[model samples]
Target chain A: MAKPKIATTSLAGCFGCHMSLLDIDERILELVELVEFDKSPVDDIKNFTGRCAIGLVEGGCCNEHNVDVLREFRRHCDILISVGDCATMGGIPALRNTVPLRECLDEAFVNGPSVHNPDGKYPDDPEIPLILDKVYPAHEVVKIDYFLPGCPPTADTLWEALVALLNDKPVELPYQLVKYD
Target chain B: MSQSVMFMIDGVQVEGRAGQSILEAAGEAGVYIPRLCYKEGLSPHGSCRVCTVMVNGRPMSACTSPISLGMIVENDSPRVAQLRRDLIEMLFVAGNHFCMFCEKSGDCELQALAYRFGITAPKYPYMFPKREVDASHPDIFIDRNRCILCGRCVRASKELDGKNVFQFVGRSAEKRIAVNGEALADTDAAVTDAAADACPVGAILKKGVGYVVPVGKREYDDKPIGSDIEAKRPAAGS
Candidate 1:
């Protein structure tokens, strides 16, 4: 009798998929009518203080904070959808899986030029978050109900998946979307 | 009109497994896709787009499409042929594909694919990315010019070997593969030899050549992988 409560959060992505979803423009608003936004960039609600029916996650688990976000998503939502390639296969960022964490940190913090934070002291400065050794897809750590999979999935594919869930049918992507055109 | 059907590729009737792409069916039926990025051991990256084929009527990458049981597929369509020529040429321009004076010259798949597709002249100018070679391993050498960004060696390091050694560091054309930040002088540290052996070009080299055949007896015998490369699927290592 009630519309489903849907929420979305991005952990470690360019947020390209969410913006691409906005590119759908009016349809994303149409999506708004069917699901209540709880904890999204579009909504101000911060903590998982209430129940949710569906949660859409749009990034891979790249660090400890990302891991915490995934666990919070799993706790609140009945079903979880990994909304992009980052959430599904760690996207292009997972390419960093080949190198050592120390090496990357050295480049980012010590050697590379952000200019102001050029010294290694900044990484050790307690304010900055710790970096993980490798980037991983969401499914590697959590139980994902479905995956929308694209660098950013097509709007129709996302729509079809939500509609399928509402209709109580199995929602798996067709080869076109899953295979990434 | 049935959602389920069977398709034929190159006169071979494959059972057409459900949820598989036409490329997979062709592979199962022993029909090769002649692609650079679709390795069985690694994740399918349709980036190279050399596996273009005609399904129904239009050209599409078989690596990404689901097989419709009654689908008609022409693996080596004129369009695919043209694209393969163009894509391989783009890869040549996109990086350094110097075949002559290279060790992997005779064995390189990119070169072999070019030879198979009859690419007599390169239609594009050299992109000349000019990235540095990562000779930072004891038994491996990564000549960036010859690197195609196929990510096979990258994947092989993470998935199979669990070493997590090869990764792309920058964005777009500036994208260069890195092995733990150090250049070749850091070879004394931990490096993966299996990942080195997985490169399809002279991009990664090891010792043990110059004895396969002597001069004069050295025959120019190159073959199309349109029917080969089924030899253990190259283990998904780039």
Candidate 2:
């Protein structure tokens, strides 16, 4: 049987979830044997080379770029898993949802206590990706097959879920493995 | 003289005191009924609805409903667990409960309940309502964003502490816990007030004491909530 291809991306996230993935320790060796990596930061692949069986997304859509990347992943992967609080429900970024977009921009750039942009300058360059009105979970933009919730799902949880998928068995979520924070 | 009430909870015969709530009897029997608005020593508010149970084929809040002789109660079933999960999800979406950044993450009862139910994602849409954080109090601050509206603080202030400093303001979507028609800083509330300790979420916090306990070391971090009550099971079996 062909090895399953897995793709991962960190969009509008702190990459803590990816760090947790590496926390799988010796299990990475087993993971490599069970699946092939494609279009992931782990392999430094900038774009998808072929269809993937699983796409592990680690953040919500905060910008147009993230939305495009998520849509691309949706088209190329058979199953897409939201892998953290960010991907599942926008995490900290979603906190800005309650505030007006202009106020947020001002706080980040213009009127911030540390900023010296006297002219009230804002990032409007064509190279910059447009920010969405509000951060949106990955599932809102594309179909999410599963969600692994955590600031970064504990390494044990990631390992257990991956092993379960590899064996085509039900994922056993032990009490200690699942956490919201 | 107190009368003994026999009941069956999930097919396990249990004995209780007459006029005692089903939740209280179940607790004495070492069965943990997940609840948020039913704190011990406090009046049963039965607001959160996380402890919904089938009492002789009728769904009722275990905390408010009294136990009876030969009563049949259903606890720890798939349907009941799902209902609890749904209530937890509604609480998650109803407020700005960002567990990752919350100081009350590990210690939060609502978050712990959600963890107990293994809620990966809420089935409801996120309602990021604009809420305010009242830091007016000298020793405490009420973050309206995280309040689950369980009225624990109100009851605690009035019933336990006798301060009557906290009360509900507004109705329905606009409803929130307020400080006796005055700003928190202007209120008579103190840091040692039971109202501060009564909040189940991060809504009411003592100033300058956020995140004192490190992550992974706080309450409910390694174990599920109500483990203390459920832990009594082994001893009860003896």
Candidate 3:
């Protein structure tokens, strides 16, 4: 029988979670034997070729493209797990939640001291994804089946959750595996 | 010495002095009843409700509820555990608890309770309420965003420090900790006051001393909260 497929993505995150996934080290060999990659940066697959048994989502929805990608993952995967603080609770990027969207844009595009945009214009290219008013955790956008809470959940946490899910065991992580920072 | 009163907590017979709260009795008996507002040397405010336990089948804040003779109390039960978890979750969602960046991440009682309960993320939707951060004080800062409304600072200021430096303002959802004066700096709040150290969350912080304890070396980093209290328990066979 064909092994189950796992898809992963980094939306508005810093890609630290993806680095932590790679932090699993030699376990990647064991994981490759257990599951196939689909629609993930791991295999450089930009789109889903088939249904995935699990989708590991990193970061929260910070833009229209992030929501679209998250919704796509929800549509293509049977189980979706929020992989870190960003995906679970809109981590560092969500600091903008308290600030007005216009002010944030102005600071970045106009008011910032280091900004070189003498045109005093915001990025309005049609190709650029529109930013959302507020950063939203993955579960707020779609039904997240599981949440691994960490600032980029430790590599052991991701590995343990994956192994448990793959083995059809309950994903009850030990105390040490669950951390917010 | 006061007369001893007998009570049953989770099927274990425990003895306490008259007028002692269930939480105090449980502590003496080596049962760590989780609490946030009830601190040693301070009056129990019983606002946080993290220490809620079943008293005669009814839920009551163990910190404020005095134990009576022959009283049957339930601590560490599933129903009470779930209640505590829900309370902790509400506190998380109600506040902008960005633990990833919070200076009180490991040392915070709220964060440690969440860790003890193994809460990955709060089940409730984040309110993300707009709150203010008062950095006016040169020696200290008050980040109202992380305030859990536990009233520890309020009590500590009035009762311990005798300064009345903090008090609750507004009503219901608008309620928050307000300084005695316009800002914390305007008040007579000293960095060394007990109120400064009484906050269970990152709401109150001393300036120039943040992240001094590295991540791995911080309290509650490896051990669960209340482990120190639990350690007072007599060995199983002793």
Candidate 4:
């Protein structure tokens, strides 16, 4: 059978989850044989968009750039996967969610340790993004078909989710991953 | 850890009016079934298999299992004895465990458990995983080599402590605990009493508390699980 077209993108995250995806070792080579990498931030495949079979979205929506990137993936993919803890439950970065947005911004920029001084003595870069009032799961904004929850979903979990989706089987998750509040 | 009005231990009638664990009964009865990774005032976590005992004739962590009425528990069965020995030997081989230099030598639960099971060396070839120490916190130093990854500290940090600071990274045998995405400062954020109160080993030692508690003087080998029970306790001062 022909390989399914897969695309991947990272938003306002540290990209740890994407790195974990690539950390599949020899199985990564196996994945290379199974699916066609269409447009991935890590794969350096830019502008390739032919109706993605599986579009893996990492990180939560944190800024304008992140929102726009997610919109693009939502527009293209057939099955959108909100991958990792960030996409699933906004992850630890979402701890910022509990606090006010202005306080967070002031803490990072205005009252920061002088290094992050947003004024930059004169003008801040226009392209620089701003943090949102709250960090949210990916599904809050866009439709998500499946979620792989973890701080960074383990490589086995990432592989398993993909294989299940490709073969139309149910994804099995360990109780440890979901049992905790 | 909530107080149970009624629970059983060893098929013999015993009062489990409080949410006491199987080990509590064993300890109260002066039974000396050995255990590592279980400390008083810390939450009961079934990490170190040294605490494994025959609950209904099957091996289970005596520290974590809550006592239910009429539950048959055996701490001295041959199977549990073998399992304890095997588990203690694994812990010894995994870490240097040089007791001579350790501060909590006489009072160490890990050492006591090993002694109870008569495990000096492991039957398997020694395979010590190399680890680094993190003393980022002024009060406490983390010896990664000593951690058995029972997740008592990690769970305490997230559930009891409310910091949700630490987490486990890697997979299976390669698994090790990490702090706030490997950033030490992340632990400073949401630490509740649960993490500190629930740590079963020296992995999460109290900062500036060693001098206060002294060596032979901590909560005895048996103390109730604190906040872990508060969730289930009634409105009373239980």
Assess each prediction's global lDDT (C-alpha) against the native: 0.69, 0.90, 0.93, 0.65
From the highest TM-score down, the ranking of the candidates is 3, 2, 1, 4
lDDT of 4 by residue, B26-66 (tens): 66644544655666655666767676777776778888887
Give residue B120's lDDT in candidate 4 (0 to 100).
26
lDDT per residue for candidate 2 within A111-168, as digits (tens), equals 7889988778897899999999999988888889888989989999888888887688
What is candidate 3's TM-score against the reference?
0.96
True contacts kept of each: 0.00, 0.82, 0.79, 0.00
Tens-digit lDDT track of model 3 for A36-147? 9999988999999999999999999999999999999999999999999999999999999989999999999999989999899998999999999999999999999999
TM-score of decoy 4 = 0.46
* Worst window of 10 by summed lDDT in candidate 4 chain A: A172-181
Candidates in order: C-alpha RMSD to true structure: 17.9, 2.0, 1.5, 17.1
Which scores better on lDDT, 2 or 4?
2
Kindly indicate the candidate among 2 and 4 with the higher DockQ.
2
State residue B196's C-alpha deviation in candidate 4, in Å: 5.6
- Tens digits of per-residue lDDT for model 3 on B26-45? 99888999999888999999
Q: Could you list the iRMS of every candidate?
A: 15.9, 1.1, 0.9, 19.8
| Residue pairs with clashing backbones, model 1 | A98-B164, A98-B165, B5-B69, B6-B69, B96-B145, B152-B238, B153-B238
Candidate 1 per-residue lDDT over residues B53-129, each given as its tens digit: 88877787888788987787887557668878899878865775544345665567786676576553345644444
Candidate 2's C-alpha runs over 4 A off are: A114-122, B234-238
* Residue range A1-181, candidate 4, lDDT tens digits: 7788999988756688898798788998889888999989767998866888999988888887778778888899989988775675565566566467777767765776765655535225787775566775677778887776554666877887888888888766543222101
